[model samples]
Target: MTGSLTAARAMAAAAARLRAAGVADPARDARLLLAHAARIDAARVTLIAPEELSPEIAERYEQLVSLRAIRVPVSHLTGEREFYGRRFKISGEVLDPRPETETLIEAALSEPFARVLDLGVGSGCILVTLLAERAQATGLGVDISEAACLQASANAVLHGVAERAEIRRSDWLSDVAGRFDLIVSNPPYIALDEMAGLDEEVRRHEPELALTDGGDGLGAYRRIADGVMRHLAPGGRLLVEIGPTQVAAVIALFAQAGLVDIGIVQDLDGRDRVIRARRG
Candidate 1:
């Protein structure tokens, strides 16, 4: 780390440091951070493994590793996260897009809709991905946090869907108007009691508003359900990402809202991940 260090050696040292600090997948993170420091793609890290690190790149890598050892998420360090085959700019102001949410995306693209509404659009991954996948579609994405709204907007612009996507700050459906053929949300469903059980990266770095509803975790769903019928077109669809243990609770909420065809979709891990329902 002091002088004339090769990329491989530096990464090996960094990985050991991360491992000692309890970072899961230390080697992978080491490789990725090295690539970031060197201004190269992660895949190219191996090509430069034998080459000596520039003083500047070595210094940069040290700073990044230091942050990672403290459990700052890799996506936050890289300033972006890949979701649904696209990368979205991310920050501590918003929740990092997760792979489990792709279950909702698949369910969304399974049907056709010209209009969509994304509630609690943390990073706009759901709405933006849908619009990107369906070029003819236009959408509105709302979040209670202005910072989240800004993050979502940046992602919409990054994916070339800003022209078709509108990002706004609203508490659930309060400021939203007009009926849409589709509505989706990956709202804050974590219960307050469960907050302490989260990983350091999530518990410390991600926005709390984007992670928990400050209650039993059903608060956002309740708000969404109360107003959904008024905003949904008849026979329109509503899709939401949910915790694995939330299937019964969410189904009951949706059913009470008079949504029909309520069903569950599991993620790659076979856990109940999304609930899809249609307006009656």
Candidate 2:
């Protein structure tokens, strides 16, 4: 923190500062931020541990740590997040891609589909990853927020899938046309009452529209269900990420929508994380 400070010493000080500020993984954050400040991969942090940081890098690290202490998300600070093995450019305008949503990705890739639709495509991780993995596939990704649509579009281009993926702004399926063999969503399922309970990073930094439906949390699902049948091809599939406690309600909603073969997929933590259904 002072003159001629080595990377190891600076990280130790930064970790202590983060720990005192209630960061959950202070050491990890310190290492990552140091790497970012030094313009090096995180894996190289250890190699530079004993070397003194340049005044410029040290100043940059100080600013990053200051923002992080206030609970700004690391992805926002780094300007990117990795989802489904791909890096996505992220901002406060969109929700950070989550690991649990990968459950939906796995369920989606379990079958073959030449066409896919992603609803509420906050960062386009789902649609873009699908197209990247399946070279023959093309997709449409829609979000109500224009900012989210732009974020998704950038990610699609970043992942080399922009040519095959279309990003648009639409409220659920309202502006969408054409049937698809697959549809996916990680909608705003958090209830209004639950907003205050979220972490500071999510509650303060991420977009509210990408986190909550401003109601009982089933609003997005209801909208999607109402229009799904009209947009789904025969035997097409629908996959959605959901909260652990939402299994019964989501299943019932899908069933009422006349979707059959409904089933759940759990995340690595074994929580009910995704619901998959097929058009009858």
Candidate 1 per-residue lDDT, tens place, 1-280, comes to: 8449999999999999999999999999999999988999999999999999999999999999999999999999999888988989999898899999999999999989999999999888889999999999999999989999999999999999999999998989999999999999999999999999998779999899988999999998999899999989998999999976788999999999899999999899999899999998
- On residues 65-122, what C-alpha lDDT tens digit does candidate 2 reach at each position? 9998998888899998888878889998988999888888899999999999999998
Which structure among the candidates has the greatest lDDT? 1
Any runs in candidate 1 off by more than 4 Å, and if so which?
A: none
Runs of candidate 2 with Cα error greater than 4 angstroms are: none
Global lDDT for candidate 1? 0.93
For model 1 the TM-score comes to: 0.98
All models: lDDT?
A: 0.93, 0.92
Clashes of 2: 0
Candidate 2 lDDT? 0.92
Which residue pairs in candidate 1 collide? Answer: none
